[model samples]
Target: MVVERDELLDESCRGAAPLPQEADRVRLDLPRRDDLPDIMYLANNHRIAANLATMPHPFSLEDAKALVQKAEAAHGNSAFFAIRLRTTGRFIGVARYANVEEGMPVHVGYWLGEPFWGQGFATEAVHALVDHAFTHGTMDELTAACRVTNPASRRVLVKSGFQYRDQSMIRSLGAGGSVPIERYNLERAIWKSLRTWGRVAS
Candidate 1:
């Protein structure tokens, strides 16, 4: 699916890049302080946190605030978007392409509220984020991982054109320990080909 820019979130930079972009049914924008309550409500679940690396369980308002602050601080080095329903404009989750360090490959990640699961929203949101990263940023490839147990997430990555790369272990603040993960990667050439062939899965 070709992701489209519905409207520029930062109008002042009209021709530069689209700060907020849209997919078929979801919108992606920077997290805001006002979104804290929605973020906390959707992100506090042990179920959601267990599958993620750094999200703490019992996700609090302060954590939500920090998340927004961090997104604000990222400038252009990283992209953190609050996923929202397009028709209703309700915050549902978050998607990000983050820099692990100064020179490491960027990694993509996302999470949706429990109520929004099993609806293809995650996949659509990921499509939009991947498009933004390749279209606007300079990264040649994007990396991702999911818990060994997270089949749904694994499916999302595959649908977004990420190929399985390897296995690794990472500490999960929510899981309270290290866990096994399956890594995946998507190269710019692959993405460009997918776009040219119109094969990006919706």
Candidate 2:
């Protein structure tokens, strides 16, 4: 049975009390107007923007606002979440299973502040999204990609049970040029099997 988009998240995503959904270290919440400064501060780095496909360098408050608007307009066909630390409630980055291709929707993407890098936040957030997508939502597969040069992100995708799919050149609006990326895919069955093996061990 295909679950409707609105029902993609509910009590099942949390528990009997229906608290905000969180993984081991962070919770995936909606981006808020109050988060503008945090988004601007974290997303303005050249290092961070270079790794992402669409994040523009020197990100501004206006960019964050436009993003917030886009998120608000999406009708739940995708899950766009602001990745926040579970303990501190600090906004570290963003993660989601949106921006899917028209023919096949359900692609995953994420980013974290440079300070939050190397702490496994990206992997943790991704694992949570993958689990939620299979449990509370309906999707057969999820796709992801990273610039071939971005080892850190590629590692996260592999750790999240995604397999190498292909390599292609895609234009990066932020980069103002085309970049090559290694494509990856994670089938729900593969993700589930990994869970059984504790491959997704936190």
Using lDDT, give the best candidate's number.
1
lDDT of 1 by residue, 1-202 (tens): 1111111122222212476789999999877788888999998999888787778788888888867765654444357688999998789988877666568787787889999999999988998999988888888988888888988888888898999999988877777898888889999999999888885655
Candidate 1: residue pairs that collide? none
Report the lDDT of model 2 for residue 102. 56
Expressed as tens digits, the lDDT of each residue in 62-146 for candidate 2 is 8888656545533333666778999998888877665344568577777888888889888888888777667756678888888
Whose TM-score is greatest here? 1
lDDT of candidate 1 at residue 103, scale 0 to 100: 82
Candidate 1's displacement at residue 166, Å, is 0.7
Alpha-carbon error at 190 in model 2, in Å? 0.8
